[model samples]
Target: MSLFNMPLLIQDTAAIEGDMGMLWMLISGILVFFMQAGFFLVESGMTDSKNAVNIAMKNFLDIAVGSLAFWFVGYSLMYGADMGGGFFHWGGFIFSQGAADLFFQTVFAATAATIVSGAIAGRTKYTTYAIFSIVMTAIIYPVAGGWEWNGGWLNNTDGIMPAEFIDFAGSSIVHSVGGWAALVAAWMVGPRIGKYLNGKPIEMHGHNQMYATLGVFILWLGWFGFNGGSQLAWGGDDATAASQVVLVTNLAASAGAIAALLFTWIKNGKPNLGMTLNGALAGLVSITAGCGNMSEGGAVLAGLVGGILVVLSIGFIEKTLKIDDAVGAISVHGVAGAWGTLVIGLWGVDGDAGIGIFNGGGAAQLGAQAIGVLSYAAWAIVTSFIFLFILKKICGLRVTEAEEIAGLDISEHGTIAYPGKRQREME
Candidate 1:
């Protein structure tokens, strides 16, 4: 389907499936909202135990603050009527859109902002990160999202290009935006203390493998709504499309996990659990953009690539680039998101209709996808850098060196994730 031609799912209560569609959207939004918990667990488990409480606080603020920011300003800028000649938009402020649309997209806004949390988890000051989340949801993410979803220049293909940009559920518009921001945040925050000793990356293992594992599981489930809900309706062809999207999403995730598990085993002689968990997330993000357009086989291929790329990207970012990402968020979301968006140009489809170069489609679709990917990356990196740099200069971004040793849980927030250990020490 053309990006502009996708169903809007506006209320048509007289239709037989109107209620069903509305319910589907609400349920999907709930599922996506629940992914916040998944993010909380993933960030906490992957980082130091001492910072778990602080990490949780960050996640809490991400949704609480992000939702309001998006609602008050970002939503209008994104979904409102175009007012910037295809760049800026203005709707009535304070979320006048349908409850379902607002609810679903609110979760997505929160999600994009929260992706930065894991990358800068252990070291960033909560106040700095909190303001960054507001800007992310209220401005950065919304502006990029408007370009496509709101029929900005990217989707104005009739006037600007030969084909439309496709991002069924925002691999680039959401995940890549967040992913790139995570990279910048991590860079600005600098590596966690002791992350690099003598310029060599040291192992900073997560405290709880089970938490990471379960977090991925929750995110995996949430991806069904993330992709399927993009269908925007449950009646007739929309139902079929939604089901197909869910199927492809599942296939891609499974393939991604298996690929990572095998890749780690072959490379290191150990089936690393962490790689496997992130592999699943990489798969979900990979197929998110093309799930509606790709066949089952194509989805698996994309997911496998996403999984492999995440592992490689993580290594390059940490070891070569010397950026410390607490949980590989940059690789899983940003790098994999770019790959997912570009791969659609290679092999995307609409049932039997071809929309990909390798599948009998022309390069127009590919070109559009490429532009969208680059646009998202550029927008995210530049905006996040501007905000974080200013924050860094004005007040500060990271915790004190003493606080680094003390851990943010105690220094930032007077609490411990595992109070028993502290209690034993005091005794």
Candidate 2:
């Protein structure tokens, strides 16, 4: 039918999609921004109450310090003109016209920085963490992210990649970067005092399971925007793709939570609330890479596996590796992020055909996924290790043993999260 005869609701989205996209980005940015509160709650509630205020301060630092760094320098490095054949860039520092996109991406950089906070909670020096937060948001994160997101060598067009590396909502870019850095920070800071004694692990339960549970619920609610808004548009085919992203995201999270709940119930003779919460987050991370290309069944499968894997991974990191990750950030984000990225090569879809090996695609896509996964791991590990090593040697990465024993809230922040629960000595 002619446009003049068409109904008002039938206008092509292309006529209005630009504005729609900006609106969506702003909405999504707000949602992603709220995740900061979620992180604060989860990290605080999952760790000792004595350290709650310290955790609160670190989370506060991540968004506050992290955002300014991303704005002034990181964005230019990531989105400015490529300077060294995708390895370097310059210009656009503290400047940009695309405000909506800029705000959205800024939140992601903050999210990456905050992951380290939970892992290093309690014993790490707050000033050192504040510095690391700046380093991550500015240099370490942006440089690696530029490689793919900014059309750098790792992207398919570089002629080095065997296939396109897909990470629709940043399972690898955002989550894994934070996860691996957390791994290094946890290792370098050296397990929390008395976390282990003579080669045996000790259980350090989080002070407030109720708060942790609430935190997970908030994060789950935010994922809808995190995944859906990644489509970067709001009409035409963008509409359908965004809808699918939301659907798959939810399904994966549900499956992840269920898998963890069931597994712990069977193995531990009861459901573990902590593990279950992490499982849901793992599922969310797992589906993030493939959400745009996955079917409902694929999303569920990925999340279920991610959920089970997180439980196993947490145990191995804590007991076997002896890395004292207070909130299990490494497993739920890093390990699950790698799995999420790699699963695309196993059963991910392209148009109507599967891009994964089991779906009739060759090993090429899998190879690419593996390469991307390894590249991120190595980059995050090496850079974070060096930075943290320096911070440890020069400025001190951890609190004094006495300060740790006293609890970071009192020792570092000069306050407590729950003052009523503490004795005068604790204060």
Candidate 3:
């Protein structure tokens, strides 16, 4: 009998559903992959022009290295058969039936790993960065992902938590994990040379505001796929729900940008462009966890809070913590991601599923969200510190003073992003 004409195949609803779902997932994955360009532009534009080439190189290599690492072991560790009571998994090595799913997940792993690059830019050794990307995608990100998305203890229906933890698209699992790791990495790498003077941070401005603004817009575009694709299905009601998710995502991003612009204008007496850009990102990260569950109003509220928190957190990290994050990745992703995840416990709702505390669900959901947030932070911080410390001892994490001042493009890559008129004049 022909496969297409088989009665069982024709009658199977799941088979038809899988076909559309896979196609949507692949499309979404491609959109997420394009986010790498966004990251490159944002990182390069936010840092010194001297390091622009190096920044671009790192971002490119992050996807390259992260994809291979995830394919080799990361996917298996995340989605393999449950072992040791869901602490980890084994098997499913190489490729399996879900190639499309694997491709989709690989991009997400890369996104988490790449978030750290901006924090340690301008001063990191290229070789060391490569190693970090591999380890992060293969081990750090996958293990955390297993815990939430792969039937691990955190999201287990019968787990220790009062209520199942909710991270619809990994605000805590992906963003916070990356953010916490970036925090540790920035600390270990130390601040860039001349970043501090007399125990106070010296102001450093990005060389190109236009590039940074363009990057923000690109990221905003990519986020529709990032949040919408998490629905994991594209048939019937799922299609409508995905559309709603995209709508809320857009609203949150706009609200976040406006809030940050106003807040910074009030505080600094002028609207800071960089802060405003980050504010949009903060809003996006804040809504990622609850976009599918929350109403548009809830998303705006979350984004508004995220924008204010990011500005405040960036100031604290710079002034009080003395952590020099070149692009504020830690504050925008980690802090806002945590805030977004926690808000789900307060505002999350899906039709009749009242799972938020303020919606009369009580403290169970809130407690679960808190536990998930803390666990991810602890795991990311501890593991990142250990890995960074070892790498520092083995190969050294930062460039020398001469190398840094000379610019990573010239010192590390032996090329300049912009040779300027000197080359033309010489010719």
Candidate 4:
């Protein structure tokens, strides 16, 4: 059965394609896994100095805990054989057949779970946070993912929706699911001590803006794989499609950063670094859903809109809603993600149908995208609320008032991120 002895015709053409796909998936998965580092840096840098180690620990634990949870249960719930009319998968628990595929998906699951950590940082009990991570990876994220990615009703070609919901690379499945959960979790957990003073919000600037900037850069680099690899194939046209996705993804991120910079400069009379960083992320999230199907121009527009939206959304969430998201995770991921998904209806280009309302495809795709957004939002928010409520009742979600003042690095992890610096007194 040596290859040289085998007949040329007997060798499978599809097998070669499969091998290429696996290699691409593996590389992309590795890239996505590195995003955890980006998250750690971003969250830690955007918050107080004392909580840096604590934030880093949670981000690290997300990958470790999430991988195991997804392997044992989440993968099955998402991609296993469909059962109960596609509401869930019946089997495939603890499975290992497609190693590359499993690895690729595990990173995505971890990402969804980690998004919540940033929102609830500093105040959460470590034990409760660990449990939340497991539940998100093993249940919440997987179930929401199953709806579209695993051939559930949302993306079902012949479902009740006007057209299939198109989330090219998980704008809704990964980002929005994470975002909505973050929002719910942040709201339920309440604000950090001194985040609001006398019914007015107070600004708690991050300890290290340099770390946040570097983290944003790393996340931008990782997004190439995040969107490009969603093509799921690497041969012929698939290769071309993937390359285009990477290009547009970059364009959108750039446009978003510029837009946010300009907007903030106009509003604040100075260019704010934090808003600029968030703008770049907003653009990336905005274009993720439609990257494969959008023109470069459309991507630019999406990014521009996303960048502006993020700034406004952050203000609204902070001022009007009074929700304290230490890193603006909910606005950047949830709000921008929803916009990106919905934009697909206006900008998407695929097949003979042309796939977007402005592209002569009518309102079918738009309607579907809307449905997908609302559905995922409801699911994520409700499930997150229930889980957080239960945890709040059973274990109490927050540390004591004394713990809040002492910093989680000392109270939770028994060490300080900056060893010698005097602990700043809580205002």
Per-residue CA lDDT of model 4 for 283-390, tens digit only, reads: 999988888768777788899999999999999999999999999899899999999999979857763235677766689889999999999999999999999999
lDDT of 3 by residue, 338-424 (tens): 999999888677554556777666888889999999999999999999998999999999999999998999999999888983377
Weakest ten-residue segment in model 1 by summed lDDT: 4-13
Local accuracy of candidate 2 as per-residue lDDT tens digits, 188-292: 888998899899899999999999999999999888888887777887767777787898899999999999999999999999999999999999999998887
The residue pairs found clashing in candidate 2 are 345-356
The segments of candidate 4 whose C-alpha lies over 4 angstroms from its true place after superposition are: 1-16, 351-353, 423-427
Alpha-carbon error at 41 in model 2, in Å? 0.7
Superposed Cα deviation of residue 34, candidate 4 (Å):
0.5
Best by lDDT: 1
Q: Give the C-alpha lDDT of model 4.
A: 0.86
List the candidates ranked by TM-score, beginning with the highest: 1, 2, 3, 4
Residue-pair clashes per prediction, in order, are 0, 1, 0, 0
Worst window of 10 by summed lDDT in candidate 3: 3-12
Ranking by lDDT: 1, 2, 3, 4
True-vs-predicted CA distance for residue 272, candidate 3, Å: 1.4
RMSD of each: 3.6, 5.4, 6.8, 7.0
Residue runs of model 2 more than 4 Å from their true location after superposition: 1-17, 424-427
* Alpha carbon lDDT at 406, candidate 3: 87
